[model samples]
Target: MAPNDSAQTTEEAKDLVAGRRRATRYIVPVAVAGVAAATIGLVPALAASGDPDLPKITAQELIEKMAASDTQQLSGTVKINTDLGIPSLGGLAELGGGSLAPGGERGESGSAASPDGKLLELASGSHTLRVAADGPDKQKVSILEDTAEYSVIHNSGEVWAYDSASNEAFHAKDDGSGTGPGKEREAAPKDLPTTPKELADEALKAADETTSVTVGGTAQVAGRDAYQLVIKPKQSGSTVGSIKIAVDAKNGVPLKFTLTPSSGGKAAIDAGFTKVDFSKPAASTFDFTPPKGAKVTEADELEKEKGLERGAKNHEDFKGMEDFQGLNIIGEGWTSIAKIEMPGGEGIGAPKDGEVPPEAEKFLNALGDQVDGKFGSGTVFKTRLVNALMTDDGKVYVGAVTKDALVKAANEGK
Candidate 1:
């Protein structure tokens, strides 16, 4: 259940998680798609174990090794396979991605990859494959064929991704760098934190009470000696069911990662590295100067549409309709219009004395909060207790934003 906006319940935190979900499906996909930024070229980094013959180590130890690496510049692709996977409800999983296919609403892939967690740096030459096992959400592995084009760079406190195709560079934070070229891109801060260990600690804390294990093997990835590590969660929990991250044993750079579920499903990510250049990037790589007339807008600002926000936020107002009656609420526009209808009911605006029942009190209370005491005013027009709810959440009760659209849909339904 979504929390009320009054800051009482942890609903706002849920909203934040919801927002991250959208960003993943939208921003990450666009950044990782098909665009390579020039100016910056460095081979992906990996740690050189003091002793090559050392036995398998913990995931946290591996991350610590990553933190000490100085390599930069690499390129590759990855595919993730899984068997059982649950729909992402909280965090960035809610980006509305039913599947990784065309026409499906896309989300950012990086939401799953935070350098602050089990990672030090995600570079161009790095390839990661995630595999899962279980439900329909994890039936097959998604092969991210060629992903060098969407190279997101992070140094110190700055994050920048360059797309050569569009000649546009995006910054993770608001650094005022337009979506253009010639502007100076920020440098990797000297005191930047690269704590994969810290991130791993958080992961263990946030994770369910279960012990996870890792084993090691070898495989050839992009013609390199890659080390394979398998991580199996002891319990059947929703987070990090099972994961496999393969890193180049020679260079210690990650080659691929696979995440799977315990129920038996699949999701895979396979990254193939093409080149690893450790040379310093050109001076122009850090700049983000937009073109003369290229329009630029913040992603958050663009999502603030009145209609869509109203629809999503009020959706909770429409649940539990086993005994809801039918009455017409004041709809905007159109005279004598019946905006909504149910299987066994009529549409007359407002409650007809005893129309509303006590069971619906909670639902109506939610709506009243949105109305902000505007009910009973002429502006609110009419109130109704419909037999059918508009959404799965008992909120969003079911009234047309405009009388015209409501009539159109009702007629079309008939």
Candidate 2:
């Protein structure tokens, strides 16, 4: 082979390997996130023995009241538990740690590394989250781990994150101009979706189309009267059977969220406050000074460098790939499908004859079942609550829905 041809082949091989790794990074999180965020063990309130016949209300009224209810100030200890039903994949724990890629950490922006995102990434395990909120602009979330704690605090025009495990702290200043550390980090605070109200709102965004809401019954959550609002997907192909949320009757705050898969079984994800107080916490709860001798880093510089690197890579790899820039949502709500086109028809690396590189093929095969579809041949990765289909044509369709849902999406798109 000519020298130039040999170099091109070598580059293609490297790209192919990198592409498979990226795909693995992308699919693993999506599949796990489906269950990790919504499926948790029943909280103390819901687990209390004895079913008292609490007043029943229409789902519509409950939703309306919840919308009007206010829970701006409060303190609580939330418990998060998840069971994906698959054997322990050591990599699963890394999901909660941050980036899916090996050694990849999220940007330093307070918003990018939000507490909610971190909590959701945790693998199948039990965790405690302590939250205190004085108002929208003043709030703190601390993840309590064995012998260590990870805390994120947003207060007085500044954002601070400290990880006790490494004794590292990150700081960013919010100048109130929408360009501050927090705003730049998250782009939208609401995107974090940690609160009961926030989670309900997120699910409701896809109501009527992809899911139907109904009041399951009344229950006690966190020693308070609460109503169970059940959200069931309308799509027959979805793997999710329903999501049950216990909303505080007095204040409309969601006290607990539980998700069960379509295949009859126990809850896959359960999260809620085991202890809560409606009163405002002390002013010191939201304050942090970054213990002396702790290594502190300014997020602004880190984010700037990351942004530059991302921009350069995007320009280099996707200069003419305008069609792949946006994502298309095939459906809405719980069963919704997110379709993204790969830059090259064959994805990151396209061998001359359309054969997947041996290494890439081996990697994918180990992760999930390989299936053939009407659109083309691809692999289907499945978990108890989520499924994903990656086609040879460089298209990916994923959802917390069933494998049939993904296949249906792939067929329809074709």
lDDT of each: 0.39, 0.75
Residue 40 miss distance in model 2 (angstroms)? 21
List candidate 1 stretches off by more than 4 Å: 1-63, 70-209, 236-241, 250-252, 263-279, 282-288, 291-294, 298-414
Which stretches in model 2 have alpha-carbon errors above 4 Å? 1-47, 85-103, 106-120, 177-206, 307-314, 323-326, 348-360
Q: Kindly give the number of clashing pairs for every candidate.
A: 100, 7
lDDT tens string, model 1, 140-164?
A: 1122325424334433334544443
TM-score of each: 0.35, 0.72
lDDT of 2 by residue, 1-414 (tens): 366798889988899999999999988889888666555544533468655567778776687677656678999999988877665534453443433432234544433333334544455667789999976678898889899888989887788988887787878886763245446544554666545455556656657676788998887777888899998888687788889999888888899999888996888888999888999899998889989988777776666765776777768666567656567898776778888777657554223343768886676578787777788777788889878888867778878878877888889889
Prediction 2 global C-alpha lDDT: 0.75
| Per-residue lDDT value at 33 in model 2 | 84
Best by TM-score: 2
How well does candidate 2 match the true structure, expressed as C-alpha RMSD? 20.9
